[model samples]
Target: MDYKTYKTDDFLFDESFRQWTAGTSPEATAFWEQWLTQNPDRVHVVRQAQELVRALNDHYQDDATDARLTSELRRLVRNAAERREAEAADTPSIPLGQRISPWRWASVAAVIILLGFGLWRYGNVNRRVAAESYTHLTKTAQVSLQETVNTSDHVVNILLSDGSAVTLRPKSRLSYPAQFKATTRVVYLDGEAFFDVVKNPAKPFLIYANQTVTKVLGTTFLVRAFESEKNVIVTVRTGRVSVYTQQDFEKAQQSGLRRIQGVILTPNQQMIYNLGDHQLMKALVEKPAAIMPETVSREQVFEDAPVGKVFATIEQTYGVKLLYNDDDLSACLVNLTFTNESLLERLDVVCQTIGASYEVLDGQIVINSKGCK
Candidate 1:
């Protein structure tokens, strides 16, 4: 029987696989689907790699029995000494009985000792690597935990083992196992993240956000759950996502807490759930306009939009918070085509058009209307 041998490089694919299993980059997660589509053979390879990593993690978690580590170190040192002795004997040098200067003999011994030490150190490093390779091995039923968070101005990308990608927003945190198991790809998230999930109908991607759980099989969407906000928002830019309440899952589960009240969101739709009431609302969003459009002419326009509505739109589009000092001012209408105004300038224009006054207060614009027009 003839068998083909595969080198370690044959497993280069495992690097990306490990990253996904480790739940690191959102960009990697986004590419997962396309990669899987292109390289179908990698599916099996990735699964095997995940299993191997999980096993290694488990093995390392176990406590060492005794002084085995110390004993190994000692053995390594002795091996080095013996190798040095052998090399000294094999080298052609001054005769053993020749009357040589003390310094020359010392120099010869010192050179041999240094060479021996180098070999021993090299061997020790290899031994450590070997020991660490299988240190984290685990059996079935053990759970692994992995987490990643990005709180920068720039978008943070992650690639999953299955070739999916996730883009996390500032102040966002996510956690998953170092390796995925047979059943599903589960992740826990807090704050906000945008997922471009890979399609894997067999193994669904589950995102646990606060009390809500979002499940998707190959989709693109945005999820926001802020500690200060009363609602968790799920916006599906492409594909679909099922948003469920914690109670719904509790009812479904016989013993543990289950999530309840879930709705599937199609492209250009958003689901907003109130944490206090556990109520879910689905709204049809006009094809989501870019958050910040470079050309103002292409952005949403208001002929005579209410001041409140206009402000809300600006807040939503620019991700800023606005405040109104007087109810009368909020009801005032404004007509404006604002495309290139800085956020503050935009607010000033709106206030002037509506016969209202505004001041920046605590990073928010507060509007005071003299009277509704």
Candidate 2:
């Protein structure tokens, strides 16, 4: 399928997309990941379509009332037809055809016990049917739980029914559903895992660990909530993720689900939830990777580029915003050429050239310096 030009709805309707999003098909995931890397602009739209699919695939319900009504209608039609047939057979006067013989009376006596048992059996048949159907309904209502315990020395590749892939580190455990409900996809995490979640905007993906909960629509991220550690940490890789305490669920309910009432983390950002203090610390990752990689072949090189232009290019390539402490540093032009340097290296050159310094604040690069003429 030519998914390149497909909108959100188109992707939702495509079975291949479903399989891909569900993470059930490894081939589809590889194809999709490659396609996304090649066509970065489509990532946002694809994520939206993925969300729509999850939201719509809830466990279905069967309406017993409708079924009963259909059966009653059929019975009524059959009775009316039988009445017409009787009238056609005799019109005004139907003759009594036969008198009960002595043999028939004897036969009734012969089967009297059997007939009584049959009547009793018939009375209980409907109740049995109701009970069986109720059992099926109950089974559906109760979620099919599945658990993965990684005992291997290497990380375990666990594929969730909803298509999210979890790379569970050794000695970790994850509990999730065999089938997800329509509203939300939840999984319990203990220890460390990296999740490459398929996007389903309508149904958000949640990872609950100890007292912390990490939620996202669709993103690549990591969660570390080992029983040995006192803090639960969540780090974003590709998209946005939100982290909050379990106690704040009431806050979400009171405020409504319209807004995320938690600390939001963008790509290359991480949030650590301190179990003791009950506080969350948001900061940049130790080694922050670029949001978008610079293809070595199509690398961009600047020669004597203005500092503002340089900042804009960095923002475009990596999607990281840069804020100037003052207008003086913002206007100060720099002379430099950059090729294949890491984003930080490029930023360091730009800042050093203008005798300024930069720091990442809330996933943004903030330049700090006195005025440079």
Candidate 3:
């Protein structure tokens, strides 16, 4: 296959590309990585294809055969042609030349057929499983549990037995034990919710949503795991939360381990777990709030402050890491005041002042610049 000419959809339909994206074949992985490194300009298209492949794998069944799909496609075209012929016989014809040609009609029919097949391929097979998993868990639990389903259009508040609070979003469901009698407080969620958990170091709070499991001690976080969605997102507002796959969590449970090491997301960080591919990605949240708003100094006005000092102040206020060479930014100075500007906005102004640029990588900001004159 001429991969150089392949677009995102073309790559998605390729077997070798899918294998490379899933890391199933070592040779494919090496080949694609080297190809990408050599063709740097195609990085965006390749990455987009990789994400789509993962998503398609997670949502579609691989057991589908080309023969079956082809047969279905032919059947659809036949039915569509027959219906068009019947409609034409009942209607009065204006002129043969004015009517659509047979090839054009066939082209339109093919496009419609392809679109319908795409929808069928992206079926709700996994969605059904995710929706039922929460209910199944709650029913099979040994302890007495209470489930609160927010059927209303607005958010519904639920006070857990541990004094923690949950604001469940519409069409979301949360199941928790009637009492915190066990060593840990556990909850099963099928939709979305914002949690404000009380501090309890000895007994950690765990939330199971779709393929991801989140564990926290005492923090506020948001989990959006709608069954219809292809990704399970966990965004931290304050403190930290450990996010891991459900498979790993189950393995730890079977081994009788009290703790499991996973991706640690602090304040202003978010984790997205693709339900289809089981891929976990960590990045900075869309909008980062200050770690402690009250603690932020009102007089944040900086006049000719060292760029490193400005970065330090931003990091302190947001509890985020800013990576840069001290020697490189040592001579760079900034004169700016930040009152309620977002993290990215502040970075934009700083980078503009210093004739530099910034990029967010794995939830940290990396500043790139030549030494100041």
Candidate 4:
């Protein structure tokens, strides 16, 4: 007979093997006999697989072995006795009772104990998988702001309960509730963040940045409000957003005070608030210069400009630093056109042009123009 190869799914084969080893069913015995005859040369492969199953059963059968093992052993013995009687009817010359070995009886007892333990462990894993499938829900209430800081420059992404995403920029702080309540989705932002909110017409998403509050049904926008800065800036990249003050709402509702209060922003529009005077100004949004062209031309340039102004220009343009010796050259100025040079190289040319010299102290470039025209 040509040997037939059997390809089996690992899980199905393991489960079937476990059931087969527990007792001698006619189906189980037939399968084992066919498998052995097909690959008689590889009989040890079957033994190794069976041994692994037995070891697992032995490990887990420690608890309740007296009750479970005794019951399982009795079932195995009865099955073996029935198999012997069936064999006697087919082969009259072979003595059925004398065919069994002591070792074969021991193997049957071991297999039954293993099968009981395997079933118990399989039940435990299923229960754990079911328990882990449930989603975590939070109670609704007024919760304190939870602040998360990412010291590294990596962008931090968070998913709100309302299915919105907020990406915080580097060196920024954002605070929101552990769970959103019925009224609105409120978040407090300091520094900068990019928001992609989910739309719910009934409940608006409000971002409180310093004195100004930005409200929207759903929109994508960027907000920057540094602590020392006098203005809170909101730039809308897409969708619509409304900007107004807390006082603006109160004033608009007054019986006698009837000035138009809220500012609705369209795409590519920005709102700036003067923190000192509580004035809100709307302007067509211009891309920030740092993100714009490297070489922005000026019609006319100033010669020997104030050191402070020069440092500010360098910081804004190439996002670099300039340190100055306060006592030596705080009032010193340089004459230069910063057209298309790397930041450090530009600083070098500026120092040379003004007959001044500079040295890098820490990450900042310090200028010392003590005695120069």
Give the Cα lDDT of each candidate: 0.62, 0.71, 0.81, 0.62
Task: Report the C-alpha lDDT of model 1 over 1-373, residue by residue, as the tens digit.
Answer: 1101221212223445445655677766666656668767556545544554444333331232225323433454356557656876897796778745434443343344345434654575455433322122111225777667796888899887778788888887776677777778877677788888988899988876656778898888898976557888888876678888644553565566454457877655688888655577876453444344654446557887777778877766554456675466656767778766756677778877767777643324566667675
Candidate 2 residue spans exceeding 4 A from truth: 1-142, 254-260, 295-299
For TM-score, candidate 2 versus 4, the one ahead is 2
- Model 3, 1-373: lDDT tens digits are 5677765545645667778987889989999999999889888778866765565455444435645644665576677778888988998976877987654564566556656666776564455454347766778777888888898999999999889999999999998888985589889999999999999999989898886789999999999998679999999988899999876777789999977756899889999998766678999988888887864546578898999999988888898899999999899887898777778988999999999999999988899999688
Q: How does candidate 1 fare on TM-score?
A: 0.39
Q: Which ten residues in a row have the lowest lDDT in candidate 1?
A: 1-10
Number of the top TM-score candidate: 3
Give the TM-score comparing model 4 with the true structure, all chains together: 0.37
Q: State residue 217's C-alpha deviation in candidate 3, in Å.
A: 0.7
Looking at model 1, residue 287 earns an lDDT score of 43
How well does model 2 score by local distance difference test? 0.71
Candidates 1 and 3: which is better by lDDT? Answer: 3
Off by over 4 Å in 4: 1-141, 250-260, 288-373
Which candidate ranks first by lDDT, i.e. highest?
Answer: 3
Question: How many clashes (backbone N, Cα, C below 3 Å) per candidate?
Answer: 46, 4, 1, 0
